[model samples]
Target: MRSTTEQTVQPCPQCGTEIRTDRRFTTWCSACDWNVDPVEPDERPGRVERMRRGIAHRYGERLLAEMTGGESRRPRRDVAGVLACTVALCVHGVTVALLLAGVLLVTLGWGGALPVLGAFLLGLAWLLRPRFGRLPDDAPVLHRADAPRLFALIDEVAACAPTSGVHAVAVTAEVNASVSTYGIGQRRLLTLGLGLWEITAPQERVALLGHELGHFAHGDTRHGVIIANALHSLNSWRYLVAPIRNPSGLEVILNALYLLPFLAVQGVMMLLDQLTLRAAQRAEYLADASSATAASTEAAVALQDRLLVYGSAETFLLRESNARQVRDRAKRDEPEQGLWDRLAAYVESIPESEYERRRRVGALRGHSVDSTHPPTHLRRACLLAGPAEPAAVRVDAEAVAAITAELADARRVVARRVLRG
Candidate 1:
């Protein structure tokens, strides 16, 4: 006689729904939208494939949205705008201070103008100085035995454009890579994080390195530093004026005489910083396009996807931690009190809710006047919509040679300036 047997049932990995089956392979859970396939894993396409799809599908749509809304790609300003704003703000500030001092001088003496002029000159010098002293070429190098494959891929992409030769490359455990220019001649430095290396495909890695090269080729390093310096000065002036604008009774009495000039200076600087921020946003778009053109559209998409995933993960984790903290606080016990007293005390003691916390995080990430880089979503969109032609590729040997020669000359010029100082 044959005996009847019962088989065990497992839940679907994708959606968490229970499944009564004898099948050995399971990939999706219908209930919770999870992937349970241990061998196959989740998202079989890898980083590059996912990015390519995202660029093809979502990049154009997002770009259109931002363009129609008149939003900037990045939070920082371009070099020209930064310079214009810095000069305008400084000039206006000096003019106002002088005008106020002139009135005082008429009543008293003529010695105050000299100090005011000296202060103005000092502010100008500070704003004009290069903020990035030297490139990260001097950063310690990390060499792992597994770096050969990654290096080979980078070499292939660099060979595609002669001017794209990397000046320095280093590996770190961080999940990001950055390209920067330092000193005179704008020596390039490329940094890659181990996290990025582990997750990114060969093509995706090439695209990232290519993006850094694009920044170098477009003179973004020098321009970015100039803009950053100008912004820093603007911020400093803003802080200096805040106390004067909203002074205490005693402070107000002391500053009452110079209030007009202080207000004028603050207003001028604020306007300049806003304009500079606008210009920087435009430059970010240009750089994104340069990167896309250097590589293929697919590669650009892949790079953007990787950035978005990393950025989103960071944002989500922060939000989750804040939420957990709130939950923990709410569980604390409290003594009973009168109705109005309890109400007031409860309202005052309540921490930020999850929604409020998330909103704040979004706001910080969405719009940043102080940041030197653009928002991740906007940067990705720009790359997707960038030029299809490979015009940004610097594959010409002569051109690379010229850039190298020019870099050497720039170094000499900077050295001379330093010596003179």
Candidate 2:
């Protein structure tokens, strides 16, 4: 027979009011609610960010409802997708037309002022060129030969996610992980952040990989070359046309001349964002479901819970960085060591009550990792509401040790950079 447990009866530490405590959740007073969310969210977003957040919060709620109601998970070829593609193609066509016109003017209108106009057109075309993503030259790249065990783990997770495997792995000091395509060939690269990697359990690591690779499997339209390059071009155009502050004389006249183009570009950007935002949000939900499939529902939910504490993790990093600076001034004899281990310990030391407090705060504020993703609470809810499946890929102890050994050099390099900064 299965066993059942009940909530533990307790009194509020601050209010002395009796309360029932669920072991799986936070224990806090219902009356006074002491020490809930000690850290408050920043209230200093710019006008644009605020508007985006408002839109994200409203749409995220609607998307969550549809997903939980068992809507189709596959990305469909809809009118929005077609319209977005059409707009992107038009943007690229404009660039191509500019290049051709510039060449024609230069060749046909020799010994005339037309050549000057051609030069100006050519400069504009150069500035607005499409930019493909590239692997950072400075980041340490890990190939499969160098880290077979880690690559094997990634390959296993890719199979479970049913996505094409990554071509290379890069490590960074940030508290995040992502998969991006780079170069003309669009070779996939997985950027793993040591700050997040060190804190996650084995299964949570699988969920992380699954979530990132899931982006590939789901065809996240935001990351596509055509749309991404068009967005980049629009942003560059916006920068070129932006009005300068404290302008005098002809600068003011130039700003006036640029105003109409600025407005036109801004309108197009808004339209494109609106068309793509829904699909992008839906893709995130599907990726979370994929993560649950690969790593089990419990581990996926736990990974989301860990995400809530990243603010505290960042705080710890800043603190350690500050402390490292002080030690350097003292001229310590021994070489610095164990920075990654300490970071892991610091994150692991956070209390369950604190996590619960942050979770509640996130829900109240509609907090998200970025404007692109849905609220963390909604993601957790979707995962929990789905089937409770076992992990599809498992890492034994031998594999874990081997993977850790492979990451040792990367860990050292990242530690040094973090400490020095």
The model with the greatest lDDT is 2
Candidate 1 positional error at 122, Å:
7.3
Clashes of 2: 0
lDDT of 2 by residue, 1-421 (tens): 1111435788778888886654544567656766554555566774445656666877888899999888888768789988998998888888898898988888887767998888888898998888877888777889999899999889888887788789999999888999988889999999999889988888899999999999999988888888988988998888999888899998999999999998888877877787788888888988888888898889889999989878767777888888877875655434456877887876776656557677676777683436678878889988887679799987788988999999988887777777777
At residue 221, candidate 1 shows an lDDT of 27
lDDT for residue 193 in candidate 1, whole number 0-100: 53
Error of 2 at 248 (Å): 2.5
Worst 10 residues of 2 by lDDT: 1-10
Candidate 1 segments whose C-alpha is farther than 4 A from its true place? 1-132, 135-166, 170-173, 195-197, 219-222, 244-269, 311-421
> How much does candidate 1 score in TM-score?
0.46
